[model samples]
Target: MSRNWTERDIPSQRGRVAVITGANTGLGFDTAKALAERGATVVLAVRDAEKGKKAAAKLGANADVTVQELDLAALDSVRAAAADLRGTLPKIDLLINNAGVMYPPRQTTREGFELQFGTNHLGHFAFTGLLLDLLLPVEGSRVVTVASIAHRIRAAIHFDDLQWENSYDRVAAYGQAKLANLMFSYELQRRLAPRGTTAAVAAHPGVARTELMRNSPAVVRAVFPAVAPLFTQSSERGALPILRAATDPAALGGQYYGPDGLGGYRGRPQVVASSPQSYDVAVQRRLWTVSEELTGVKFPVG
Candidate 1:
């Protein structure tokens, strides 16, 4: 509960098996790198094999790491990767759903769903469900879903138009996706509590300098790039909340972590609360059901 929780506070991860999506760059890379250094066998589940390999290599020669292709934008790819992971790993101590897309041009995923919603929320939703069995049997297992401060913006489930077929606002869509991430974590935690086999927690990078911002608008692109270093934290620092949510002994299920600085833009990791909208039980359950229906990947647990 200290104010200055850093990566050094992460407990020894020896013998643990971790699967981190989008581990090739940004917060995911730093998260995977830190865990691998702490002795966890990490699988950098990425969309590109070459990038994953390069990322693995960056962790140094001795880090127990490997690459698994996981393209969250595609449902078939998510299923295939999950199946492969289940067959290979006997147990998973940590499953970090850290991959996401920011404010990009209007596009649909392979399934014809909105790109950000599909990749950021639905993709991880399906992947986690497919692999929940692996974590369900392991004691102390944790599922860390990476959300964002954007969830507090113009976010809603948008059930009537989940794909934004009629209209699209990049920032609003991104907010919906991020909001769904937090909702998924809370709902998953509720389901996991009874089984006592795993915990679901959420963390945010707190405005760190990462490649996820490549989709920013023209004005933001011009100004953000120049001002980022002065205001934003490094990706390494951004990964702290994630690492903390994954390894902090005192961290509880359904809890959220982010930077403790003013407006949560940058600082050390600490337990932080999400928007009240994120905790809406009705919306959470509805989204869960809708996600399962869309992905056809029902979790083994209730």
Candidate 2:
């Protein structure tokens, strides 16, 4: 019902502290750039410190930007990053879970969990839980997770074989992970509601042309070059939804944002609905429990 939202709509983030993962490139980088431009103290939590520093440099010396090493694929790295952040930052305004893998060959993470689920869902679950104390004390602080449109296609939590050990389907696995992201956001919102300090939100880029596609299927990659202009939006445009979710004062907990075009492929960012399945509360709780058990991380809320 509201007019189309753009980065220009983002309120000034002066004095706010935002930490975004995978900020070296693509949607994450764009999100960071927009926030920095608006005067937010931005921290690029990336796997490669050098790349993050390079990315921060592009934001210019005026932008208060820093880099922290984080590798979502490894739980140890996630723990170390969280501990380091807790020690440095007294409070956090935004925690954007933006880094993720997509459609990579069937592989396992350092902890032997499926790569997609481990890095995309469980890793974030642990990281957010570990850093939630800082966010819980900061009013208006938010935990925004970047989900995907793939969540509606071929996605279902395979509880029995969550690791994809029995079989592997790249698309399905990716869908499952994204779906988990959405569910996690929703569940987290419900948990954070009592205190009313921090909000949990989700957003999707909606077919943005970004480096995330480097691991996509060969067929998609081969044809992407030709169809990208026609079907996909630029990384900056794609990041609008995420930016809105992170900075929009009107945005509430449990909200999801994405493109407002045909099939949600492209256009301006707007509040959008995720797949019906993503709203399954029972499944969300189950996933949360399992995630804690697997990651050995517990949240202070709920």
Candidate 3:
């Protein structure tokens, strides 16, 4: 593998199908573009169908790109989208759980889950579980989840009040959600390893200039633009880690990919380590159980 891996290093994706959430813009759009350019049939699973269509249009007529309605904030929408895909597609080569919320105000999903936790973690959990069978039988199938550096900042699985019913701190909620994304990937990989057909991997964009941070604190939103050029990379560059995780033949289950720069802010993609707490097997299992209970979705692997 190249030390400074970029989109040029991606392997051929011909004849494969990639389903990416939040594929309308930002890192997700870049990932979809790269795969489509490499001959993969890309499905831009997004909350807004119009935006998704516009995004697919940007990929040009030569690209085999389609749109699927998938609002992670609502379990009903996740189920419907999964069902639609399962009904249409015979198999899926890549399932990228990439859509997410950042520092939004105190809010909840349709199912009453905290906005970040519900959409970022639990939504993907249900969606993945509901669609795992499609990837399980296919050779070299992968479930590439996008996590974040926030997993290491003020993050923990607060089992006592998982939904922040009593108190709400947007930053902590986002951290917990991102951390859960990592934990879900690791735990899912552990379960899929015995099967040896589908692999689960995680990646993070570092500090990419994207709309995900639109809801960030006012100070950050105000100051981020001026310093963004120095501190952040383009969405295309930020998508490298995710593209690698989804396409790199050398990538293995339970592995993570992120930027190679200082503090993982910007650079080419490389294998990276997540926070220590994300490796806790006990917590991972517990979170899985809780997710299943909350979403009523169970994986075929276990």
Give the count of colliding residue pairs in each prediction: 0, 0, 0
How high is each candidate's TM-score?
0.98, 0.98, 0.99
Per-residue lDDT tens digits for candidate 3, residues 1-302, read: 78977788888899999999999999999999999999999999999999999999999999999999999999999999999999999999999999999999999999999999999999999999999999999999999999999999999999999999989999999999999999999999999999999999999999999989889999998999799988899999999999999999999999999999999999989999998899999999999999999999988986
Superposed by TM-score, candidate 2 places the C-alpha of residue 106 at a distance from the truth, in angstroms, of 1.1
Which 10 residues in a row give candidate 2 its minimum summed lDDT?
1-10
Report the lDDT of model 3 for residue 25.
96
Candidate 3 residue spans exceeding 4 A from truth: none
lDDT (0-100) at residue 171 of candidate 3?
95
RMSD for each of the candidates: 0.9, 0.9, 0.8
lDDT of each: 0.94, 0.95, 0.95
Candidate 1 lDDT score at position 190: 95
Tens digit of lDDT per residue, candidate 2, span 1-302?
A: 35677888899999999999999999999999999999999999999999999999999999999999999989999999999999999899999999999999999999999999999999899999999999998999999999999999899999999999999999999999999999999999999999999999999999998888989888998999999888899999999999999999999999999999988999888899999899999999999999999999999999
lDDT of 1 by residue, 88-198 (tens): 999999999999999999999999999999999999999999999999889999999999999988988899999999999999999999999999999999999999879
Cα miss at 204, model 3 (Å)?
0.2
* Model 1: residues with Cα > 4 Å off, grouped in runs: none
Between prediction 1 and prediction 2, which has the larger lDDT? 2
Residue 137 in model 1: lDDT: 88
